[model samples]
Target: MTIKASDLLKYDITPFLFGVLYSRIMPKPTDDSNPKHFYVYTAFRTSKAVLKTAFSLSKYASRLVQQYNSLSGYPNWEIHKSSDNAIDLRLYIQNDLNIDAAQFYNLVYKKLRSSTWLNTATINEDKKYFLRGYMESRGSVDTSLKLFAQDYFYNNRFELKRVQLLTDDIGLPISYANFNPRNMQPQFVSGENKRNAQFRINLFYYAKEIGFINEYKALIFEKAYKPRARIARDGIIYFQISVPNLNSHVAFIKYINFFTNNIYDKVLTPEKVGILRKQIGFNTSQELGQPYRNKSIVDLFDELSEDKCALCGTSQTFKKKANGRQSFEIHHMIPFHNGQEFDNIANFVKLCPTCHRSLKRGSASKDDQIRSIITILGRHPEVFEYTSSALGIEELPKLAEEIWSLLG
Candidate 1:
């Protein structure tokens, strides 16, 4: 009998089966037409935790198949240690009932990637379980949460995009990064021009949404969410979460305290507070009450150029209207709506009112706008540096194209 899609739900193993299929290495199928036999082989390797999880899953699957189909035997399963000190877990299933292995694999694979399957009602739990299994197989938790698959997989880009869609459907937003071979880790590097498709989500979001099933991963995720504070050798107090690197400056300690206290309890105690206050020679609380001023875009532009338009060199005195103010505007090489992180001095440029208006969306001429953008980026190396870094664009022409699109 052919294995039907409904059998997945009938056996209550849709999520688990999909998880195994979506793993880093998918199941392999072998067929023997002479006697009408089929064999499915699934293998997994990496950590002991994954091995144990996969082993248990394999046994669970075997039991389910036996009970539901009333099979006389269970699927073969084994664990082996490789010469490289890596552990490998393998599961083999023989289907004598004439179930097509290739067809069954494709059916489950399609279900896993189907948008309709994701939107099905009462499947939230199943979705979480599916993600958990996939995470155990291919996910990693560090400063960020990442899920990756080798580039050689058939329709790898489509698969990665499906992952992004699944995460969004599950209410956890994830971003996809195209394969960059040069920056790939040694293990991920292989055949020429081969790379890996990666999906990244914020650690806090991952912890809050779909948590870990592996004991070690759970511990790491727990520790990462806890807040901690420390004093550096330079006499600066650093506040951090998940990783050791400092995220904010000493001036924002009060803000950090507020966040930690409200979210995870105050990480700093009264004793540590006293020590910090004494070392810094000030009450940390006062900084919160004091007004913190960041330089305005106009102010940043003035620092880089005279009180005139950087594009047309129109002096403020000459461009002054009846109100006695220059018509120069501060243009962002990278748009402000992208994020506040790009709201820095390097991304701002002073432009004449005419030049600024010409570069905006729905301008009269696209050529003029492109020329103006190229001129602004070429004149200011810092703007190019900041824009390129912010957008991850390398070449100036490509960066210019990206900026043009952002402007539109």
Candidate 2:
């Protein structure tokens, strides 16, 4: 109850935050004498993870948890943590409290979920954020030959028949995904080995309707996602997306390249790009080192700074390139496409290779963060001319004064 609304933004957690309100309440079981119980469960991999979960769980559920204990006159039912032989890497925490769970569960669920912050977050963006909480916790990209390979078609379309929604390893069709995962279990649904085909189809549809799926894949193109689901011969349910019109294998290659290009980042890593290059027989930009700037542009940037780094004041440059001369890198104060018409000296900052590379790593001190960006803008006078538009997030002139006062 002490949790402030603003503090909620510090962590990424979702729907289970709401779903617990709907599903975890159990009332008196045909007898009034029996104490009612409520349960909330979670898994954690590290000590910090466990602590964070405990804090979050208490923040979200503490009010109901307290009211139940107070009314029922029972001692607090603390969170229970344990590890089982069946699952490693995950330590479990379950709160089994004695209370009239059903009575308070509805009250708590409605009150919390109906809060303006949550009620307003009902669309695909909300769903995407909610799902990403899961993905960041446990999802991965499927870059296998089946998903990443060249296109195949059934009827003059770039068809990817049976694109998998979730691999069986992590246990998809879970209740969080709005599916009865139990349906795929051996003792459930008549021991059927496959289920949740509809869920998989919708999963792809959602991924496509949104531009990107997690941080790894994007929908290939507009009007290009057509999905179906089938129980594979191997008894696993697989989602299909084989309806995009692919005139040639070349077009399929282009789609894959575009996806790879967009998702390329330090997290995606150069090694994965190397593997995709070898396996898919195509390239995406180039391996992560540096973007190739024009030779004349680099020379001009170096001259503008008189061979000193605009960022860290580093002037050291080694004669390491094939030519006898040392080198520096030219950086854009604001990316060219966002506001600036083209790359030029007025929009550029000159940083020796060391400062430029170090900034890219992004694990710098606060002073470094502010000082470096300031240095870049100082060198690029054109940025001030378009300060209201550059970088696509222009602060109002009044807002700049407010920031200046705050800093003072």
Candidate 3:
């Protein structure tokens, strides 16, 4: 509701500082029938860009959490006493008391103006020791990033399969992905397991955060991503996130051009190179994390009732004329050839078993699936054609570059 912080001294801040401040949210009301059931959604300061447009009641709040960390110790912002990470907060609030939107905006703006640091004397001295100690106390890098990723993937947990099929070796293909998750329960890292329990915990928190707001979860990748490496016990773990279906070959060509054009002109960090390569290469499962059927994903779709037939677009209520059986099956809308091109959530759908088998067997064609999607989208036929063309063009160069690198 209300937030205040010291200053936006970027030099003294750490990512962990942001996490700490983000952990707090306005408490949920116990009474379901209460007239004022307003909610506060929490996210990274960077995320303010996205959520600001969606939540309309007008009260908004934010704070900058600063921390310094080192091998010796860190600081804790929660206690507010001062440990290692120097915690300075900037708080802002938007209130909707009159149930009037205009008044709420004024209240929120006024709250932002009032936020200031409580401990001005301590942070001004030295940020390094204070910030370091705070981060150390906050938690491990694994813990922090897991929380961040969990929150990011919270809305469409089902999309986790897409992330896995693209990145993990053990992930299911689009067609087989609709099988009951309860059947595959043994294969996953259960909530009971302690190995990387932080990832699971963060995932649970993420699911709740998205579920609470009743928002549709979707994954959007940046067009270009810089790569970075983390020191593993052996070599290094190079990772990058990018738009999934860019022309791989074209990407490589453009990247080569960009590098030849700009590498020498700027300080090309290992991260930048890493970003270029995340989309390319034979990413071994050993270097990357394993894939498992994410229950979160299943829960997401279950909540949305999105498991309609991928081929015939039939609902579960549909029954077979001959057998009188209910319908519902997972279908890989994209052919196998397109798997490498685009088999993410946008391309997968639930279909009746009869349609699924028919599509696979070629008794019925994917044209049905395409037509259904087109009808649902309600756009010009050329919209699909040109979109596919653009998608193919974008990835060709990147794919070519990858091939050349492999051959060379």
Candidate 4:
């Protein structure tokens, strides 16, 4: 049956309809000569469920085109897998219901890039669907919930202010962080020297208000929010090394004077002394000296390796926690949760926090799980041998699959 534009308008789903269209729509060559021939297309690299929701929401826009242009069609949207295996949901819009393709393309698509449009007054009260659509297209969940804007979008202070205002109104106050081009690779910098803007959302308010419309994002959100095991005291203790004569109060002052170029009398206030103590090895109570202890297998591995993440090869020297210790997480290639037998050193892999989070079971995508297994096995082939011996799986692919299943 041909759905009329008027019938679709009666439902008042324009906020969401336009939101998806605005965020995901691709650029097409302009044909100023043919207004009636105006058509719009948008695609998403997302799951089938997200596409289905978009497909349902797009029907309204399709009906608008059908009724206005006097066209008849059962399904106006197309869903297919792209070459890279990502699902693509494409919508073709012609003519207008309340707003036309050109208006949407200009007011939304163009303005989103060149100017600000996401304000409380413009988006109206029912902003959840609109935010969901935008997030589904450009948002990501990791250590933090964030929405990415186009390069230099936040360079305009007015636009940044508007974004802040809008998010504040929704009760999900966001913090903006600019990605400086100097810190990025030269190849990544554009001619305008602009970098992408990131808006970090308040997770607590996001959970209460706008949740994810994409199933994959929802799963990742759950994992990102999941409580993690506290860093073991033994793990922290392993980094502690005793300094010679640091325990002697007189020697401590002498060492401090040497480092401070003998300006200790003038500059070393009690507060400065306390801070320096903590920076060295002193506990909060001003306790001095660390007892020598034998290093564990994990510590040995860390020392023997390049002091970098095994997966991404990022140097741990630069990635430090607030207390001034290097950040690293020990990931089990064959998780011990499957069996305590896999808890040996052969199964262990050092990962940066980001890579570790990406590899979490159940929450991680199948592709990530498989890729990690491949990367780990490539680095330490002994892991495969150990797993084969333990699980009785002979073939590499099959063994990897077994490990993947065990992960879940």
Candidate 2 local lDDT, 1-408, one digit each (tens): 222222322343254333222222233342432233333322222222123423333333333334323322333333343332111111111223333444344345335434443444234344333333333222222222112211111110111111111211122222112211222223333433433211111234334332232111222211233345332322112335542321232222222222322221213334543443343234343211122232444353454245677767766788756666567777655444443233443445667887766555345554565555655555533343333222233444432332222221
User: Ranking by TM-score, best first?
Assistant: 1, 4, 3, 2
Q: Give one digit per residue, the lDDT tens place, for model 3 in 164-242.
A: 2111221112221111111112222233421211111122222221111111111101101222321222111223322
Stretches off by above 4 angstroms in model 1 are 1-12, 24-85, 95-104, 110-117, 120-123, 142-152, 155-161, 168-171, 175-193, 220-408
Clashing pairs in 2: 157-245, 157-246, 158-244, 158-245, 158-246, 159-242, 160-242, 162-240
- Candidates 2 and 4 compared by lDDT, better number: 4
Per-structure clash totals for the candidates: 0, 8, 61, 0
Model 4, 252: alpha-carbon shift in Å?
A: 45
Largest lDDT belongs to which candidate? 1
Candidates in descending lDDT order:
1, 4, 2, 3
In order of appearance, the predictions have TM-scores of 0.36, 0.22, 0.27, 0.33
Error of 2 at 59 (Å): 23
Q: CA shift at 344, candidate 3, in angstroms? A: 4.1
Query: By lDDT, is 1 or 4 better?
Result: 1
Which 10 successive residues of model 4 have the least lDDT summed? Answer: 234-243
Error of 3 at 148 (Å): 11
The per-model lDDT (C-alpha) reads 0.45, 0.34, 0.28, 0.43
